[model samples]
Target: MSLEIKEQSEVSPFLSDAARSAAIDNKEKEIKDAQHENDDIMCGFWIFKGPLLQRFATETMYVTIYGVSGCFMAMCFAYFSGTITTLEKRYKIPTKTLGIISVGNDMTTMFGSALIGYYLRKVHRPRWMGIGLFTIVIFCLLNCSLHFIYGAGEDALKLTREFGDLQNITGNLTGSHKDQKLCMSEESTCMQENSIWGPQLILFGAQFILGIGQALFIVIGLAYMDDNTTKSKTPAMLSFSTFLRMLGPAVGYSLASVCLRWYIDPTTEPLIKPEDPRWLGAYWIGWLILAAITFLIACLMTLFPKELPSTRARRLKCEKDDIQNPMDQQMDLSLSGMWCSLKHLATNKVYVYNTFASILYFFGYMVYWIFTPKYIETQYQQSASMATMATGTVALGFSAGGVLLSGYIVSKYQPSARSMAAWNAIVDFLTVAGILCYVVIGCEGSDKLSSMAVTSADSCSASCHCEYVHYAPICSPNNDTYISACHAGCTDNTKDQLGRTLYTGCQCIAPSNSTSVPELQYAVDGPCHVDCFNQFLIFLAVMCFLKLVGASSKSTNLLIALRCIPPEEKSFALGVGSMVASLLGFIPSPIFYGWLIDKYCLVWGKTCSNKGNCWLYDTQALR
Candidate 1:
């Protein structure tokens, strides 16, 4: 020690103190930069490289374009859900058939994700996105073709001819026509039964295409975004992208609400007004518009590089073969590693158990979200548009808020796996409590309301001999709901100054006094009683709280699932977990619930031979 000190003392006079201090500061800064660069940032199931230190000029554009792409990915779901009832009504599809369509999506999502995830390591990302998006547009066009073909062309002729036998018939709702049959001839019914396969294929094929497209766009787009950005910015990019995606439901439902009021075939005149039960909307036009927007974005994104300038450092860390397209290179496609990971995941008690829990969570979620619009419309006697708008408001607003709030909590506390699980457990428990409110808080079914109940043929519409075809609602003097002006025995139909369709001289109105005729009665559209609005409000409030409690589960589930598994198995775990949830939850929940709903059909509308679709629900019978 003394010899080293003596040597340093002799050399000290040659060096300036200021120079020494500057050298020490430079060494310290280098150490700090090295430490920052070496840190790994955990985001969902992926870990990203950190702190590039230098800023790139093109990050803003990258973030904006990716976020919008995410928005496009989300558009289909929101629009489909908002307009499901409209599709059923227009195409004469039943709830069970619609559930079948949903199953197509769930089934493909699992398979598509598995395929896309494995091959994504070897494919050019933007190229895949473009191809996927184009397929989406094509299938969407095919799906839209239903409107032009089914109800307005040769297909319509078949339905018209099938129903032609019923044209001469009257008052089939009751056995008042007991002397004669009210349905079609046996020959017509037999042929009509086989014809439904075409429409079914069209619906299922379009859904299947959409499901594949969704899987490609979502999984590949996210992976591409992560690969091309610095860790410091990647989290923000993904979060904002997700946030924008949620906005799609709001926009979709709002747009669909307005468009649904228009005739499905723009060039043809609608047989009934928007408020009538028989009205069909322009559901296909929106897809064309979405396709156009997606095309523009997809083309623009093709110009984006595989990796950004900041990502070059990380790219160079891994060895690679020289190729014209980096993404086209071969990857580790062997099944052994994946199988080993799967086995490891299956044995990890927490991961397996939590995955099971997620199934129940998703099942409950699907039952509520997919059917809430129908529920609101049925319970409140609101129009389809109004119900969609109402549910969208709750879904878009409360769910987004819940996600942001949960993210904030995670950022602030940096909760460990155990802590996060505890929080989710508490939240889910409360969610169940909130879910119970639906049974207790709902408005009485339309059948229970004096003014809205379906009346028997003997009491009210027996003399009218109504065919039950026209659905222009009218209220009787007894404050009871009748199917239409025809059902009320109204001989005259006229429009008032405010453009309200009025039915007068309704014979179904019983006399209040001992007089032969009742004072001239008028029945307009919609519910006559305004008091039912309160029930809808109460229902919305309960739903709002339920949303607040459980919305974060979606993002949190991925977090816990990833945390519970080995680092190497995270991607596989997520893919497997998603598949399990879909199989147990998304694929079956709708169908199961649909079966239950079918049992409560008060009136089934005819569509050729087989049971067509439910026109009126027996709300009192619904569980």
Candidate 2:
């Protein structure tokens, strides 16, 4: 053993440097492979796998919560305004005053939209949503208090007194100097008492608040949803959100109608009367309940996560490194770009045609929804609550049809942007036909008997007293009746001539000869004259069809436009389109329509009268 150890020591020597270098190279390669594997794991779903479900759940909850809230807000706006319009008519306020109030609300909405956009860009979206919800609560509270603040009962009594006295006088004066003078005097008086600014001011303020809340809630909620969702799903999500929001108005109006029915006194012929304290209380209760709901929504908003996880530091870094910048190009904020786009829209034949067609289609569609309730009230003699319910139900049908048709069309046609343009034109043609039918029906008046009266022979005398008589029919509330006696005592210029006029008094009579002489009876009855309910139903169906077509086409066009652009430019394109549409579609249209309606009434020889109940048509001018 000692000899073997001595031999090994003599042969041993240090290793060559080349071998060591090879070993070091092998280790370095192994480390590089490990690093590549680690990178793959981080980039793949496995890195944050545990949190994935949680994140998705949060996003869905936020979307659903906000969607429901948005729907409630929309319903409140539509329901309250519709109810208020009925109240105005019942209270005998000028329609123009209501117009101004509505205009003010829309203006506030415009400003609110702009403000929300600015704040969304500058502040946290969650905070903005919370603030908007709080604002809605405040506005609803104010709306509830308006009935009391405006002395609704007192105001109703004043109007009732004036109109009641006018009705009595018109019923008594059939054909004489006093009748002519009274007619002229009543017309002047009605014109003088068009609107009291107090109630109008309150309404204007309430509407302004509502507008602010709606604009803020809608725009902010949408922006948040867009920020949270995948780009491909944005449009579908938006459509779903719209559908949900529409439900609010339908439900709200239904509830309001129920409340009105429950509280209203059927014993009173006209449900909303001067001395009916219940009217004010009912409205207040409804609004207060809505306000409480809005307040709860505000509280829920506070629980919304303070920041979106997608916008977190780690996620942003990951996205920046992995994906191309979504918004690389700066927005073109110059006047030249705007002018160019406008010129392109105006001069391009396809663009011009589509734009004009869209305008006309939307115009007809809006007119149907806006005026349908009024038509129902005038034509059917329905209560305000009933009219609201009818309108809401029709709107619900339209909404349901629209949603279903939208899905079918999108799947079936796979339409391109150009095809959307064509479809819009087609919808316009159809809408025009529907509108024509509606206008004809509206102008035709009612199919029911125009006037009905009854007089007893026992009520007449032998002195040739020539007493006139009138009675109220069950259906028509605004009808008037006139009676005169042609006898020896009934001289052309003598006070013995018993003549009488009946205007909504239900019953009026004058003394007449006992002999059942030829009593000239004038009765007007036809379907063409009193069928507004059928007209409204038809109008609603057509509006639904038109809106579905137009909305689907517009949505398809947007999708096509997005497809044409690179993914990075999609958001900008959508934003620009929305801004343009708001300016062109919504703002200009309402103003122009309002002006046109007012002008139409002025040009026509229409007057609001107590006997003829011409005020019904007078309010129609506002629509």
Candidate 3:
């Protein structure tokens, strides 16, 4: 029995060693298998036996879909901003009324309501985005005949010539001048009607459709990217997507700038040069083409597996994404679930703070985007093509570069929430300095012109009555350009041998800062400047650079909001934040900024037969 026990004990050690060896061999095999898997990913021999398309597409392809969607949306927004002035002129939309109309675009979120976000969370994201884009296409096509079908263009322009123009000039002028022009311009008791609803409604309705697409495309696409991809890659992917998105605006505005040079119908040569503020173009064509492209992108986005087929760890992460707030469990998928998640988001301090900063930043940006072109045109009297081109450069080159750079920096550092806040503050401070440049950088706008109510009040002729509403500007003999013959106080017009328009008997023709009163009584078409184009360009360059600096951030605003919320509420948090920003920033910015712009009006131009545009502005008073 003792001998048997001894043998058994001896065999136990050998058996234990054999078990250890097997474990070691199994581990080595696992290592080899992992290496093989990695090799398949990297090598050309990764022959897939699965579905053809699905085998080839990486996670980044999904990001590419988001990028394409954003790019097309950016194009639409750029088109809208670039052509707003032309639309205002064509539609006779007032600054205040236009603001109201802009607000109508954000009706989906109730101008920042969280309902859309909650709803999207429940629905299939790509499908919702697809449907929204499809609706956008339909509505945008509907707007094709907006000007032709609903227009009173000729009538509106004449009405302004007969009345609204006088009200604008007389209202700004002193009592005696006001009293004098009121009789010739219109009845003193006359009430100019608010916006006519037909054309305005068309714009509002089209924008509302666009707004839905915008909300769905931006929020859902962004969330889909985040949810499907690893956290480490999100910033880089987002940066790439945003870069493409910004490229859209650049391309759109560039095209619009070129198109604006020609008449609405390219075959029909423009009567007035592009320098004339009266120039309009085929604005509808841009929407038509872009809509087709966007629709295609939306369709392709659906091909990406609804939820990316994640590995074990990624699947676990996504399963958590399905969790509702308060407990990391499966979402209830009910009204109660949405409400609870939204409440949790609203109370998140980091989210709330980040939201405020974002909204403030958006406010400055929205104002800049909407008005920079207008400012360029009015401040420097640049042609629409030139102004839009410059604006596009900023949107494309500087702004896109800034966004990409910021995203790179964030990816490199992966900043904490506090650091992100600090970065935001610093960027905004720089932006303020850039914005303040508007107060001084611009030259005084054509003070020698008859439209300069401050400088040419006495020279303005009540006799011409400005009945044509034609912005055929003229240069006084002293070399200052007047907006038109009527502004030069000309009693009669004569055609030169070349058929160029001419004016005689100008009252505001005295030499400026001269020793003796010099009489230069006649004026002719085109502007006269004493060599300031170079200086104007310098201001624009400085403006672009500084604004670029001000606009860029070293951190991600989206990440800030996302990190502050529970994982389950990330999408809902973004929605609420966007709503808040639109409510406080985007919705009201145009209105208040437009009002500020209205303060600088020198001459108002009517659209057809209604109240129209301020054809001329006091550049110095623009701030």
Best by lDDT: 3
Ordered list by TM-score, greatest first: 3, 1, 2
lDDT of 3 by residue, 58-117 (tens): 667767767777777777777777777777776667666666676666666444346666
Quick one: RMSD of model 1? 12.1
Model 1 Cα lDDT, one tens digit per residue, 1-623: 67445444544465688875565566667767665443322111123222332232155666676667767656666677777877776556788878888678778877777666654654556567766676667666776777657654322221232333353365342332221212111222211343566777888888888777777776666566655666445434555566666677667777667777766666655434554455566777777777778777776555554445555555555435332334434435678756665677788999988988888877876676677777776666777777778777556777667766766666556667787788778878898887777676655536454234355334565545444333334555556666556556565655679855566666665644567563465566433442457888888887777776676655555556645654334445656766777788888998988777877775555544556666667665563
lDDT computed for candidate 1? 0.62
Model 2, 1-623: lDDT tens digits are 67445433443246455755565555566667766534322211333334443444355567677868877786676566456544553344444444455555556665456434433443445556777778777777776665566544432332233544555577643444223222121222222233355556766787777666666666666555665666655556655665666677677777666656543222224323321221322555677787888787766655554345543443457567886444324445456754554454445454344445454545445544444554566545455677767667555656645654664566565555677666656766765675565554442343222221122112331233222211111221223222222111122222222332212211122223343332212111111124356666665666566555544554554345445444433333333333444455555555565455444221111123312111223323332
How many clashing residue pairs are found in candidate 2?
15
TM-score of each: 0.75, 0.62, 0.79
Cα shift from native, residue 605, model 3 (Å): 2.3
CA shift of 72, model 3, Å: 1.1
Residue 167 miss distance in model 3 (angstroms): 30
Off by over 4 Å in 1: 1-64, 151-195, 224-237, 267-273, 315-332, 449-454, 457-473, 484-509, 514-531, 563-568
Off by over 4 Å in 3: 1-50, 111-113, 147-196, 311-313, 316-328, 333-336, 445-460, 463-470, 507-520, 526-532, 606-609
- lDDT of each prediction vs. the true structure? 0.62, 0.48, 0.64
Worst 10 residues of 2 by lDDT: 520-529
Clashes of each: 0, 15, 13
